[model samples]
Target: MFKKLKITCDEATTICDKNQYGEATLLEKIKLNIHFIRCKICFKYTKQNMTLTKIYKGHAKSCKELKHCLSDTDKEVLKEKLNSFKV
Candidate 1:
C-alpha cells in the first residue's frame, strides 16, 4: 500500500541526516526518496544537508594537515571559563 511508503517531513529529515552519516538503512533511504517525490521542502533540506556535509568533509581533509593550538593566555582564559562553569 502507498501508506506503507509514506513518511512525514520530520521523518524524512531524520533519515536525511542519518543518510548523510551513512547510518540510514536501505528501507529508510527508499522511504526518504519516496517522500521527496511530493515534498519539495524535504528535497531542498536533503540537498542543503549534503552540501554542508561535503563542505565540512573538504575542510576536514585540509585542516588535518595543519596544526592549530591556543596560546598560553588563551588556554588560561579557557581554563578560567571552564572552572567558572563547574558547580
Candidate 2:
C-alpha cells in the first residue's frame, strides 16, 4: 500500500537545520532529500541555505584580509557614522 507522505514546514526546517552541519544521520538525510524532491519551496530553501553557507564559509576564511583591505579613512568614517546612531 502507498501511504501518503506529508511533511510540515516546521519539520522541513528542523531537518534542514540538522543537515546544515553535516551532522544528520543517513536515514534523516534520505528522508529530507525525498521531501525536498517533492516540495519546490523546500528545495529552493535548501539550495539557498547551501549557497549562503558556502558564501559565509568563504567570507570567514578571508575576514581578516577583508578587514585589512578597507582603507583607514573608510573605517574611520564608518566608525563615526555608527557612533552617531548610538543612544
Candidate 3:
C-alpha cells in the first residue's frame, strides 16, 4: 500500500528542515509540493512543524543579540513557547 508514496525518511527530514527555513532547493520544494498534494497527513505535519519552527526562531531572535539581555521571565516564556512544539 505504501508503494505509491515516493517519500522516504531522509527526504522527508531534509524537506522538513529546508521547508522550515524557506530555503529548500527548487527540486526539493517541488517534490514536497507534489507529495503534499496527495498526502493530507504529511502536508499537515509539515505545515505544523514549519509553523512551530518559525515561532521558536522568532522567539529566539528576541534575545539573540545580547548575551545577557534576556530577563528570567523572558527566558522562561521563550522556553515555554518552544517546548510547546514537542509532541
Candidate 4:
C-alpha cells in the first residue's frame, strides 16, 4: 500500500508531467506507479494529463507542417503585407 512509494500527490503530479515530456527518471516513474496504484485520483489525473498532452502534441506537429508549407519568400511577402496593414 504505497508505504515504500515515498511520494506525495504533488510529487506524483510533477512526476506525471515530467513523464509526459520524457524527462522523468526511472526512479521517479517507479514512484509514480506506486502512487497511482494506491491513489485513484492521481491515476485519473495522470490519464487526463497524458491525453491532453497527446492531443496538443498532434496539433503542434500539424501546425508546424502547415507553417512550413509556405515558402520563405511567401512568408516574407505576407509579413510585409501584414506590417503595412498594421495601423
The 10 consecutive residues of candidate 3 with the worst lDDT sum are 1-10
Query: lDDT per residue, candidate 1, 1-87, as tens digits?
Result: 889989999999999998998999999989999998899999999999999999999999999989988899999999999999995
Alpha carbon RMSD to native, model 1: 5.6
List the candidate numbers ranked by lDDT, top first.
1, 4, 2, 3
The lowest-lDDT stretch of 10 consecutive residues in candidate 1 is 61-70
Clashes of each: 0, 0, 0, 0
Q: What value does the lDDT take at residue 74 in candidate 1?
A: 100
Tens-digit lDDT string for candidate 3 (4-68): 44676567667978778788887777677767766777777887897899799989898686576
**Cα deviation of 51, candidate 1, in Å:** 0.8
| TM agreement with the true structure for every prediction | 0.67, 0.57, 0.57, 0.67
TM-score of 2: 0.57
Model 3, CA-based lDDT: 0.76
* Residue pairs with backbone atoms closer than 3 Å in model 2 (clashes): none
lDDT per model vs. reference: 0.94, 0.77, 0.76, 0.90
Give the root-mean-square deviation of each candidate in angstroms.
Answer: 5.6, 7.2, 13.2, 6.0
Candidate 3 pairs with clashing backbones: none
Which whole-number lDDT from 0 to 100 does residue 21 have in model 1?
85
lDDT of 2 by residue, 1-87 (tens): 112345676777678877888887876676677787678898888889898889887897888565546889999999999999894
Give, for candidate 4, the lowest lDDT window spanning 10 residues. Answer: 62-71
lDDT (C-alpha) at residue 56 in model 4: 94
